[model samples]
Target: MSDIPAPELAIATRNLSKQFDRLLAVDNVDLEVADGEVYGLIGPNGAGKTTLMRMLAAIEDPTTGDIYLQGERLDPDRPNPRLKRYLGYLPDDFPLYDDLTVWDYLDYFARLYDLREPGRSRRLLEILDLVQLIPKRDSLIATLSRGMKQRLSLGRTILHEPVLLLLDEPVSGLDPIARQQFREIIQVVREAGMTVLISSHILSDLAQLCSSIGIMELGCLVESTSIQELYQRLSQQRLQISLLGDNLAKSLDRAIAELRNCPQVESWTVGDRQLTVHFNGNETDSANLLRQLIQAQVNLYQFQIETDDLEDIFLQLGHQQTS
Candidate 1:
């Protein structure tokens, strides 16, 4: 063996793939997730994200390739109690018992996981609190709102306190408030040392939560990198200048005329009371441009730099096109 030490990974796969009849759902995917990472997967519908997640969750067998979890080979063919204890998977189509109360449903799953009294009760309470469902614990599952039901489903998924969590489209249909709540809960678990692999179409939420992101197209992982690095590599700089007072129209016209001949400005659009310009310059260039505008009597009210977010980067990569 060489002197180089292998990097520790929470999840790793070698040329992983899956096929259904004629369709190759997940094709030759090599993924690595580090310990305590919140990895986000983004893609259009039918891009194989759900299928890949199923294989990672051990609910589906790959057509070819090897999967390793924490350096241990994952052999789904054989029963591995250790792997079971370390993993928690919540699929998109998770089910809940409509007749059972929230607490009762959680208790049922806790027992299924072989959790005994005292400890089981303690774990249930902790989960309820973690998912912000403590207040509705005694209510019937059918009575809970869509958001509340989803939270309860998540509570069941982590009842065993698994170290590795696989969540597929967890916030698919939740309202803004519900999505925010779900994001906070995920952050808490991440802080508690859970390695989360979450796939979602909501790029804004992923931009806020993920340490790194993987973009899928067709059946391939087209790009994977840290969010910061993605921004540095593909994101562009923009400048927004809003005009002041009742002479806003005149100010906008002057700003447009100034931007028209500026070598630092690539392009610009005229908005109601502002100009959004694509700038190809550094901080000093921006400051100098502001000074020029002021000297030209542009009547500027606010000058701001707007950097591209994850959604912009995704669109820039052109991976949002349907497979």
Candidate 2:
């Protein structure tokens, strides 16, 4: 009997780097996405997100490092036709034949991918329906709306039924409804066991769809973690208080210093009657801190504990890049 093969990761990068002359576009970035996961490469423009995605898609070569798809190391010497069959790439721009109808256009690529007979027609129709382009199957590519064209581009990418997808800014120009539709399509693809690597500046969209996120900054992957992990790592346990009173800043500062010196108080900061206290021990410590603050004559107008979210994490990482 033959030994069973180990399950392969959908995408993996080891110290991946790309340089254009002296400028490093992507610098020693390590990324991994499990099979059937929607992984997002999120950052602002010129953050090297596109360059990294292009390398993963095999459209461009990396100046340094390695990429593996399904446990197969991508190398120039070992050209694998199977790689193309297992990957789909949707660039930021959607190229289309102006004169060709939607069905004809998809059929053309389907043929190129060597889909034949019943399978070709069946796959094309299925993708058309998935992208909601069934009604416009016969419509000329030029006649379709921007949203429809985007969907058509997606359909073209998936026509070959590739297991991995690289989408660069897939929802950049889309309206709200179109964006929602695109998200739905992505969800369906995930359900079908397709691994996706999506690059987008829209953090909110990524926050909603991606199973994991990598934040890139200045050609480096500053942070890469699961969304829940990110939230937890950046979460704040201290409570914030606001006070409305005369000489609030001085009063607050003195109170905070006293609270900080307390055995139960871990640390505290105060500015303009607003105080933040981190309890060292537990709920008992927090209660002690609050009691101490009140006894110290720190007038508190409002108090609340706040936890950080994905946006907060992104901003914190961005700030680290600039500073």
Instruction: Return the TM-score for each candidate structure.
Output: 0.90, 0.79
List lDDT for all candidates, in order.
Answer: 0.89, 0.83
Q: What TM-score quantifies how close candidate 1 is to the native fold?
A: 0.90
CA lDDT, candidate 1, residue 194: 96
Question: Any runs in candidate 2 off by more than 4 Å, and if so which?
Answer: 1-7, 236-307
Candidate RMSDs in Å, in order, are 3.0, 5.0
* Model 2 whole-model lDDT (C-alpha atoms): 0.83
Best by lDDT: 1
- Cα error of candidate 2 at position 1, Å: 32
- Residue 177 accuracy (lDDT) in model 2: 91
lDDT of 1 by residue, 125-159 (tens): 99999999989989999999999988899999999
Clashes of each: 0, 0
Residue pairs that clash (backbone atoms under 3 angstroms), model 1: none
Number of the predicted model whose TM-score against the real structure is largest:
1
Question: Residue by residue across 35-100, what tens digits does model 2's lDDT show?
Answer: 889998888899999999899888789998888888777775667788768889999985789799
